[model samples]
Target chain A: MRDFDLLQPQHLSDALDALAQNDSAIRPLAGGTDMLVDIRAQRAKPDVLVSLQNISELRGITRENGTLKIGAATTIAEFLKHPELTKHDALRYAAYVFANPMIRNSATIGGNIGSASPAGDMLPPLLALDAHIELVSKNEARVMPLSDFFLGPRKTAKRANELITSIQLPVISYQSPVSSLQSPVSSAFYKLGLRQADAISLISVAVWIQRDGEKIRDVRIALGAVAPRPMRAIRAEEILRGEIFNEMNLKESARIASEECSPIDDLRASANYRRRMIAVYVRRMLEQAWSKTQ
Target chain B: MQKKTILFSLNGEPREWSVYPNELLLNVLREQEFLTGTKYGCGIGECGACTVHINGEPILSCLTLAIACEGKEILTIEGLAREGKLDPVQIAFLDQTAFQCGFCTPDMILMTRALLNEIPNPTEEQVRDYLRGNLCRCTGYASIMRAALDASVLNAHRSVQSNEE
Candidate 1:
């Protein structure tokens, strides 16, 4: 690996200053699981390395005003341990199947999202949850929906001077148990990997739904590993939303979602196999989520 | 390229090295520190052959930068045995013959150490989850799994005996 100056910033503001000064020449090191791999493989060669380990503010999970704020440096293991996060089935399940215990101990959700892999385990769940990223720079800061944060594979909407501070997810409230007649919000996530652990996704699906009696009031279906970016199957969601989630409708939505993706034949799986698995996984996720609402 | 004095505790001993920022912890421990227990397998984070404890958590040393570990406490396979006493995990592996080629032994032991530290009595599924990254080509993991369970029991037994004394 080529040598670079490691910059250990004492303050978050100092870190932002260094990033702003060096621009693209500096890479923020979080977890070091992904960054170190890229550096060793000659895929990334940043002249200066900015270590964020000392930035205490970017390292915990918090909730306020019905919004969940997870620091960008929070590890996957930390995400799994949060009591409130575990209650959200989609988020909990994604964390459960993300890599293994070793990787999760160091792999941060921010790094996972920043790497912008279309097959990122957190992307599907974050997309389904309607999460937003808080990006801060030396001069200013801004927040954007997580769905719009990814431009393509390994590409993000973040500018060179900006550092992702936190991921904000609005807590979805379920119908009160006292109102037994009202429908409740439910979600589910499923990933199809080559092996049980540490394998990247062949295809993955997540669904967030709220039902009114037998009809789906609102729904969002996110698919990964079958596209250049983790994306919502908007047309499929449109078809399923406000419609009775019967066998025929659910099957049709799944078929549409599968057909909408543009996947290539990769080393892990074939494009055709990915499409089929996407359909199957999406159907299963939708069924599971629908059942949970009942 | 820049170099700095990397100071950290290695196996409970203070160690320092003047090295490049890009130097991997696995290489530094094996080459500079002359601690070769942690083997380099995949060079990437895919394999846990170079797994070590950073302040108590198991991470791939090959994927970790030496300079970034300035203040962290590192625990490798060499640290498992202290004052001529073998760790229960080491004894269990010896008794069960957990390894054949023994290439991935240190990694497995260190991973098991971290696992049993976290979950004193873990289920079979938990053991599988914890050691999934550490691959063993010779033993095929059956004996290793058995040894890990035995290690848990032995550790608990040792703790009880010490407490009684």
Candidate 2:
């Protein structure tokens, strides 16, 4: 890696100041699992690195008002250990299959989102959860839906001078008017990689659903590694939102999801294969999530 | 970039070292500190040859900047043994002949120690999952698995003996 000045900031405001410097080459250093690899490969070169490792503000997981507030610097290992995450299968499963134990110890949630890779393991699950990211600058702070954050592969809506502070996931609950009936809300994630560990996804899917009797009260499906960015199957979700949860509708929604994605032929997998697997995994994930609601 | 002095605990020893901003912890340990047991296989963090414990958790040293070690406790393979006696995990690896090329042994041992620390009696599936990142290119995983199980028993025996004492 090329030599660069390292600025270790103890406070979030100081880190923001360092990033808001006149030079656009200044980059915020989070876990360094992704950025360091990119730098060694010459894919990213920054003249200055603002280390956020010492910032206590960006390292925690908390819940308030039925929303999970995850500090941007929280590592994947932390997610695996957190008690609250176990209730959300999609996010926890994504955390479970993310790289390996060694990488998870150092890879932070913010870095995963900041890198903005289409195959990032956390993106599809977060999209399914309807996560909102909080970005902070020296002068201002803003919140935006994760769906609007990614523009393309390794691209995001974050400004050069801003830093992602935390990710907020709303704790969605479904209630039945009749006390005797049961309402279930569940989410599931699946990743197809070449190997069991440390392999990037060929295609991945996440599904979140609320079951109201025989009909789907609400649903969201997210796909990864099959587009320029991790994306939602909006049309397929629209079809299933109020429809009966049945095999025919599930197959139709999965087919629509496969058609919605625009994947390219990559070294790991062909575009045709990815589209086919997308249909299979989408259907499987939807089934898995729906089964949990039962 | 100017060189900066960092203070951290290495192998239970307090040390201060000067490093450039971009210098990786793997290089500093191998070159400056002369603790070369940590091998460099894939500098991109894919290979676990450079694994070390930062604050008791195993992490990739090649991808970690040396400056980041300031005020942190780092445990490398050189630190795994106490006073020239091998750790239980190390003894198990030697007894089981867990490696062939031995290029990935240091990281494998470190990761095994970390896993055993977390799960004293981990199942075979758990052991495989935990050590999945530490790849043995010689494909000597069967022996490695045996060594991990043996180490768990050895660790338990040692703990029981120490408790009796």
Candidate 3:
């Protein structure tokens, strides 16, 4: 890694001040799992590294106003251990199979989302949950929908001096108790990686469905690694919304999900292979989601 | 470049060191502190050869910045044995012949210690999951898995025995 000035801020405000002072020349360091790897591989280099480990405001999970707020610096281990996240199968599955135990202990959700990788395990499920990010800077703070946060591969809408403070996700039925007349959330996430452990996803799918008995009232399907950025399969979702889970709808939605993606051929998988796997995985995830509703 | 000297507890001893911002904890342990038990398998975080305990959690030292070690307690493989007595995991590994080349032993032992510290009795799947990050090309994972299970029982026995002392 290239040598750079290290700024250790004792507070979140101080960290923001350091970022504002250094602008694009500085990068915020959270768990350093992704950032350190990028720096070592020479994929990223900055004049200063601002450490956020000491920032208390950026470190825990909370629920307020019917939303789940996860601090940007909360490690993947911490998030997975949270009682709320564990009960949500989609999030738990993603957390369980993400990277490995050691990496999970050191990688943060904020860094995962902040890195803006299409293959990020946490993004698709979070996107399926309709999560939004909270970005803070010295001057102002703003919240952006998670779907709109990513601009491209390794790119985001966040400004240079901005620090991601928290990720707020809607408290869906899966995260709360099922009340009378309230349709329980049925969600599932599937990742197609080369190997079971320590492999990046070639293609991944997540589905969030709220069914009124056998009819799907609402559904959100999110796909990852099949696009430059993780995206919702809007066309596929539209076909399944207000429709019953059947062989025909499942096949059509799966086809639409595959067709709507924009994947590229990489060493891990060919673009054609990813598209096919996307269809298969989408069908599988939808089946899993439907089974949960029963 | 801005440099800072930070104080942190290492293996139960307080130490102060001046380090560069980009210096990784793996390099600092091996070079500055001369603690080479933490191996460097891959410079990136993929390989867990540099696994160490930071505040009772297993993390990749290669990915952790040395300057970030301020005020935190770090435990390396060298810290496992105390007063010439081997850790239970080490004893179990020896009895079960868990390693062959021994290249990944330090990381394996430390990872098991961390696991047993949290879960005294782990299921086979849990043991495999926790040790998955520490790759051992020599043992084929069978003996390692056996050793991990035995270590849990050995550790539990040792704990009960110690509590009575």
Candidate 4:
């Protein structure tokens, strides 16, 4: 690694002040699972490194005000271990999507969201759960819905001085003891990769739904690696909302969702393969989620 | 260079040291502590060859900064045994011949330890998923699975025996 000035601020205020002092030349550090890799690979080099390790507000998981507020620096392990997320629909789904134990224990959901990789495993779930991000700076702080946070692949609405503070996810605590989803909604996250582990997705989908009798009440569908950023299948979801559960309709919706993706042909997979796989995943996820509702 | 003094617990001991802001925690373990069990396969986070348990959860040491772990409990493969006694998992691995080339052995063992810590008795599918992070180019993980399950059974037997006694 190239020599760089490292600054560790004992408090959030100090961290922000350092960021304010070196606004353009500073890059804040989180879990560094992603950032360190980028730096070592020569992707990014800032003159000042503001380590967020000592920032107290950037850690922990809490359930308050009917929302699960997860600190930005909270590791994926923290999110998975969070008592509330496992109960909700999308978050529970996202919690199980990532399989690598090391990544789960170290990679922060904020860094994942901040990195804005189209293949970010948590984005789909956060988008589905209607989560919002708190981006804080020395002078100001702003909140953005997870959906609007992403600009494109590897891009976000984050300013130079801004640092993500926490992600607040609205908890879906509604439970029907006499219903199929009594045991936290059954979720299926399918990411097609060359190997079962350590392989980035060629295409991935996260689907979460609430079943009302024979009809689906709230259906969320998000796909990654098939678009520039993790994107919601809005039209597809719209098609399923308030619609009676049917395999045929689900398959058709899958096709429509596949049609929406602008996948690129790369060495990992062909664009055609990704689109077709997206359809397959939509079908698989719906079938799995629908079966759980049953 | 970005250098700072850090205080952290290592293998159940507390100490302080100076580390580069950019230095990976794995490097500190290898260079400072001389704990060579934590191997480095990939500098990036793609490979799980440099995984360690930070505060009871398996994390990639290579991706972790030395300064970030100032006050966290870390468990490397070296800390598995107590007072020279092999941990049940280690015994099971040795008994079942879990490794071949052994490059991935330490990571696999630590990963298994972490998995068993959470899921004491994991099914084959769960084991596969839980051990998904660590890679083994040799042996295809057949014996590794056997060893992990065998260790669980052994631990269960010991627990039951202790209760009975």
* Top-scoring candidate (TM-score): 2
In model 1, what lDDT does residue A269 have? 93
Please state the error at residue B115 of candidate 3 in Å.
1.3
Q: Give the poorly placed runs of model 4, Cα more than 4 Å off.
A: A21-24, A63-66, A172-188, A210-213, B157-165
In the range B1-165, model 2's lDDT, one tens digit per residue, is 999999999999999999999999999999998998899998988889999999999999998999999999999999999989899999999999999989999999999999999999999999999998888999999999999999999999889988999
**Candidate 2 DockQ category?**
high
Poorest stretch of ten by lDDT in candidate 1 chain A? A174-183
Q: What does the TM-score come to for chain B in model 1?
A: 0.97
| Top DockQ prediction, candidate number | 2
CA lDDT for candidate 2: 0.93
* Model 1 chain B worst lDDT window (10 residues): B131-140
lDDT of 3 by residue, A1-294 (tens): 688888888798898888886467799988888888888788888888898888899988889988989899888887578897786678888988888888999888999999999999999999998889999999999999999999999999988889999999888534335555444677899888898788899999998888777788899999999899999999999999999879999999999999999999989999999999989999999889878774
| Poorest stretch of ten by lDDT in candidate 2 chain A | A174-183
lDDT of 1 by residue, B86-141 (tens): 99999999999999989899999998989999999999999998898888888559
- Runs of candidate 3 exceeding 4 Å displacement: A172-183
Instruction: Supply DockQ values for each candidate.
Output: 0.76, 0.88, 0.81, 0.66
lDDT of each: 0.89, 0.93, 0.88, 0.81
Q: List model 2 lDDT by residue over A1-294, tens digit each.
A: 798899998999899888876466999999999999888888888999999999999988898998899999999998788897777899999999999898898899999999999999999999999999999998899999999999999999999999999999998555656652454888999999998888999999999998878899999999999999999999889889999999999999999999999999989999999999999999999999998775
Worst 10 residues of 2 chain B by lDDT: B39-48
In angstroms, how far off is A42's CA in candidate 1? 1.0
Selected candidate, larger DockQ, 1 vs 3: 3
User: Which clashing pairs does model 3 show?
Assistant: none
Ordering by lDDT: 2, 1, 3, 4
Mark the 10 consecutive residues where model 3 chain B has the least summed lDDT. Answer: B131-140
